[model samples]
Target: MKQDNEAVGAQEESFSGDESQSLVPDANYQEEFSWFSVILPFLFPALGGLLFGYDIGATSGANISLQSPELSGISWFNLSAVQLGLVVSGSLYGALLGSLLVYPIADFLGTEEEGTYHCSCTIPSWGLITAYAPDLGVLLVGRLLYGLGIGLAMHGAPLYIAETCPSKIRGTLVSLKELFIVLGILLGYFVGSFQINVVGGGYMYGVSAPIALLMGIGMWLLPPSPRWLLLRAVQGKGSIQELKEKASFALSKLRGRPPGDNVSERQIEDTLISLKSSYADQESEGSFLEVFQGPSLKAFIIGGGLVLFQQITGQPSVLYYAGPILQSAGFSAASDATRVSVVIGLFKLLMTWIAVLKVDDLGRRPLLIGGVGGIALSLFLLSAYYKFLGGFPLVAVASLLLYVGCYQISFGPISWLMVSEIFPIRTRGRGISLAVLTNFGSNAIVTFAFYPLKEFLGAENLFLLFGGIALLSLLFVMLLVPETKGLSLEEIESKILK
Candidate 1:
């Protein structure tokens, strides 16, 4: 251990002496851009996000179908409003459990392997169970299992994308995960529209099974994160030379370069030194408590706060209950409401694309502040329509559309993107897991409480409260969130976190 400390000290001195090279591996070296290189790695991991979105979209219609008299023959089909909320929000509670479960084990498991486990195991199991379930108890169990997969996937996917992809396009790629999420939602709405009349919504719950199986198979073809390999090495998983050899190979695969590439070799050395320096003061790898101290605490504040606001402002509740909300707003027929949800889904998809294209170019804070302000305005408009203009249902529809569009641009994508960006790599897994736990925890609360709250406060008052939260969120972004447009992860830690 003493000798290891000496070697790390020497490497740090060599790293600091080099004035031309920045701490970020990508900052010092520029590889020729390859769309294939970038997109191939991103595609499989993003399926995790798609599954998350599909759950939201499919459940929206399922909520409607469960209320139909056709299935009322099932013993447990006739549910109270509170029981119905539990049925709707079951996966979210499971997601909260999944996030907590993964926190301590994330570093040990690594992101790539976690993806494979969730996709192959939890996701498919839930689909099969939910599809064939004959009772409400069985259905809730299946949804809870599925939520466990979502918790794992959501935590791993963004971290994998951010760490492996080129920094220049980091924001764009991470934001694209949001694109997949909305795409899944759109696909779910389409499926729900066709299957709304089908008893039990079996096909709707079963759709993700085959896709998840394929994604699990595809995950085997992708390389593990290079940074994760180096981190493990620093934790004494292997020798220094082994760390170099393994990390260099992973970097070559990620960057579409030859195994013997000199640039990849240099990056491995630099990253190792950086990792060592981060661990210099510690006796072991970062503990969960480490996430609460100093720089990691700051990251948690920003990342956690964003995700908290993301849910408390009511995005999940709106999407999960879209069919019911629209029906209440004047599209009395379930079919009409599901069709309108498709339109809303399409507009959301389009708006997310704008963020995907512009996140790297326009920076983070401006988009967040602007888009959140729009969200607040739309929420207030929704409240006004419900309160005083109940006669005009079109106003409610327009306001709902505006709310969905604005959220797609800002809070929907940016919140996750920033969470993946803000943490130091050493404690990144724990930090992000905690943030996601907060997210799903908040989501479960809002979703489960929606019906009761709507009944108690009325739709207008509920929306007005959400609008007030949105205004507070906008203020939080302006004052606290920093612009992370183009910085590399190491640069973010050394510069921004400091």
Candidate 2:
């Protein structure tokens, strides 16, 4: 322990004179900022979020399409309730499997390569397979493959965005990932509306294929994360001086500065010292066991808990079955229900934009706590409409919109944002992989059980249970989650984790 402290001290002492001054932002540094450079890198990684959202939106309509007799010419296409649940949740189960598979390999691959591989490979493959599947088994295989990509994208995008962005704008950039997801959902809804009667939902399933291929190509054009380069240096992938040169080049590009500029060089040197200090007392690479000890353990508890609640409070089930849920609330026509979903998607996009604007300014806790409080209230309103106000269909619609809007501001984006922020550099990859695993595992369970649970508990009682969970989530944020707005990754590790 004493030796560890000494190592940290030595690392800190390496920064001197102008190098130390670079740690504090100056007017010239502010003037050098290029929004286009920063936003360009962020845009490619965020397409992963779009893929996840498109699946959610397209599947909602696909569920309705699969129920029609036109597609039921195949004996198995006329699915029982249990079989239908499996079809709707097949991707989620695949996502669960994908998260477990990615846990050990996350550190080795890094986020950029992971994003590129999954987009270029998994997404297009799933789209083609699902679009032309001959039977239930084939369709399900396609869903699982698509879901595998979602798990990878969901794990990598936020972490990449968080690491590459300037700290002052980090919250906004990271939150834009959720914005892309919402846009995808909206796009999916529009396509589903047009393709609802198409045989076997082929058009709906195939639409994202070309777009995902384009995104994969774009990923190749962006710079790698500077922090990831530094991590490779710490892991002894190459000589320290050689890796530092590469890291400096990447950082200069990200900061929109000339590589040889004095300010850029000082900033890179300061970043290196901060990263080394963060890693000083730990092993060059982190192990699964190490993640459960001390500060990493605390980070897991916070990150894991947020993701757990994010699903259990019922966001996935609500979005996944929105068309049917709206139908039950008295939009009797299937087309009318899908149209309502598009409107709801638009509201969700707007709400996520509000969060992107306010997150760095208002801090994480306020949005989490306040939005959760609203979520609980919305759930209760839904329960009331189902139980005693059955005649008032509009009340249920209003409550559902409220729930989606509140969630956009709270658990929807913030949970992933916090997960990206909390872990130490060494264990961040595995730590976040575990959190994503927890997220998908719970989502699969909740989504698969939504039909049965609603049947058993009734819509009123199930919503009430979700309302209770939302209240508990609100309490969790108030008591345990810290405000991380405006802090650098190194500062967060030293102050919050310690």
Candidate 3:
């Protein structure tokens, strides 16, 4: 009996060693990645995408009601563009706050120490907020705080997904996060449309905000990443098995695992040890500042510039003010514009779904080329519509929908996917954060400036400018963006440097 027990122990040790080797195996990680392994890592990050999309789209729908002529007397619309900008930028402000604090929070929440969070659900308890209660001032404050909450949640989601996932499916998973983001937008638009059409626009706000809160609360169903669990869970602090159980539950939705069957104790221990070792290797990889100091310049340029080009696509311009843009083009009032914009949102959701499904099979560059080409074509037609016919309202409308579809299928998902793929694991969180921040910063800038630019440049020139940028982006992708369809993170990293 003693001999039998000893043999079992030996087999476990051997399994651990083999798993460890697999974690940083010297050669091609691409060939080894499987679907089961790739999908589970995306669960939380995808939720972050959902939150971003939902919150942003919810606002678009809610804005129509918020800014309606009937409610113009309300304090919400009493403020100037600066104040409204503050309100509109409130979430981004929260996101910035969250971004500032995410690393530490992730360290604390995700770390295995005794006081740290061992379960995913614990975060919402910390993030519990009441942004929509009474006063306009209170609601604004709450919204800013909610943005921070989302910011805190958003940073961790993609970082976790990128690091935990293998490269073969990394692009797909990262893109899934973006897809969920678009989904949230579509859902918010759909829900808001129904609410606004049925009741007043303010009712739309009333309906959507609480829904976000409820979803935030639902996050607890998943386990802490097993990587976080074994590496950071305190001794007697968290049941590794509990984390595994919860992770199995959370991961089940993404990968179709039965609640408890997906993760085992041995798998938890192995992944954790692998992450710890990977973390150690990461420590020596390079400093975030130092990452861009030397031979990494080419990569830094690509990563940074790609994000900039992503914004230049004029996608957010369409999203943030789609209804307004449509209305300006003669679509009726803001409410009708929103209803039509929802159709655009639906197109975005469907195309994004297509992108996610085919990204692995179709390859990144082709999608990007196709997307950029489509954006140029759509924008050119749109500019002509605006220039020739007082923005031939109907054509403007159709072009906008096509623009959204083109973006979702190409730049939207691939941008995030490539950002994750292009950077090294050691600097991945920081690198991806830099890329995401650039994305938001550019988004905020363009969003605020689009109105002004349209005022100054006129609608035709505004789109032409974006179309020109899209052309430049096409050139950039053709020249620099590497084909990363089947490569693992490490393999991609090696090839990029070589």
Candidate 4:
């Protein structure tokens, strides 16, 4: 890659820019990044991603046992249709509430503090309650709370990576959290599948408790976000030298700069300038409405619009109701149909792993366009197979695998990565919250509409609808989204808002 050293120190108008100072990193800064430092944030915080994914897969995977009178999935496995609907969708509704709360949480209590509370304490508490709920209503409440916790975690996890990670590999690092999500889902599937009859089928719901509790404790020990500590350092509440020391220590750990003794004198000075500039960019604390106006609007559109297309790609529908979809296509045995979900979980986990590796190398734009274009074609073929051919089970399976592959690689991970990347730090919490709101909003629409569409148009025409959306998404990426590979956060803002 060519050098843009000159661009770093140049001042530009910014919503969350460091204090009018030129604090660009030296071009070679990334070369000295430590592997240990780079991986720790993912290890400590990305566990939250695992917990979130686990909740999603755990509920759907356990649905099989819950419906099975022979197993202990749900004590009220024989509930009425209306009751079952509530049981299943309770968490998603909670997630919507959590996503919408982001702006208020940031404006009032602050995202840094609020995120810790949601992830560590709220999640574990809800998981345990859901695990041991005395009745269906209690279980529903627990599930709803679980959704709220993970919804907040989803916002916090990616935003943490976006802020801590250097721009050179931010997409890849952030996307890695997406893989942990699928891995958690995969674990939930297998865990529930193995102990189908365990604890009255409450195993899946309760399993997250220990993990979340551990995560809750781990968060207390980890340092607060450097950006956040800087934000708190407003109006000389403390010494500027002290803020720089803390920021440098945390940033060095996250970005992997050498220790003060080992770093070159000039590099140390440049690092301080960059840190100061970043702190300077923080918006005076207020409502998040500022980003919705003026130059920031472009960034918001790209962020929100990207997640909208991601949801419309039909992933939530597939995840929530894979059993019925599989059985409809030809897997007649209920146990077989349920087990196939395990296969789907594994497939998603593996493909997303590949995406974690490739996102940095190929850049975000090519992967988004390529993966979604493949998804569009797969959806069209799957629709035709279900509609016209009717009896070819293997064909349906193959098409589904192809669709899953395309989705995991493209829309699945990149959407989250871009959400964290595109927004400036000033409104990042709210920006990502809005994008997540878009994601959950689209997911809710698709999830609710899938059954109705299936009833009226059948699976064939329904998928054709998704196929059309996927095609539109391709055009959206091609024309509107920029290639954000290897650019610093401030540089990206400068380029996009220029």
Which numbered prediction scores highest in lDDT against the true structure? Answer: 1
Which ranges of candidate 4 are over 4 A from the true structure? 1-26, 29-34, 72-75, 79-82, 107-112, 120-126, 166-168, 197-199, 235-283
Give all TM-scores, in the order shown: 0.90, 0.90, 0.77, 0.84
Q: Give me the overall lDDT of model 2.
A: 0.79
Higher-ranked by lDDT: 1 or 2? 1
Instruction: Summing lDDT over every window of 10 consecutive residues in candidate 1, give the lowest-scoring window.
Output: 11-20
lDDT tens digits by residue: candidate 1, 76-149: 66678898888889888888988998887787888898899788655555678877778888888988888988
lDDT of 2 by residue, 1-498 (tens): 544544443332222112333455563543346888888778888888888888889888888887777742355567777777888888888888878877877767877877887785555556688877778888888888888888887887877777677655666677788899999888888887777766666557788887788778877777676667766787778788887787677766876888856765666676677657667666787667988998899999999999999999988878988888888889877678888999999999999999988887898998999999999999999899989988999998999899999999988889888987788655777888899899999999998898889989999999999999999988888899999987755567778988
Residue pairs clashing in model 4 are 16-281, 17-280, 17-281, 18-277, 18-280, 18-281, 19-280, 72-200, 72-201
For candidate 3, lDDT tens digit of each residue in 196-243? Answer: 554345444444344444444434443444444443432335675675
Error of 2 at 282 (Å): 3.3
In every candidate, how many clashes are there? 0, 0, 8, 9
User: Where is model 2 more than 4 Å wrong at Cα?
Assistant: 1-31, 71-75, 239-242, 256-270, 273-281, 485-496
lDDT, candidate 2, at 169 = 61
Candidate 3, residue 337: lDDT: 73
The worst-scoring run of ten residues by lDDT in candidate 4 lies at 11-20
Model 3 weakest lDDT span, ten residues long: 111-120
Return the candidate ranking by lDDT, descending: 1, 2, 4, 3
| Clashes in predicted model 1 | 0
Of models 1 and 3, which has the larger lDDT? 1
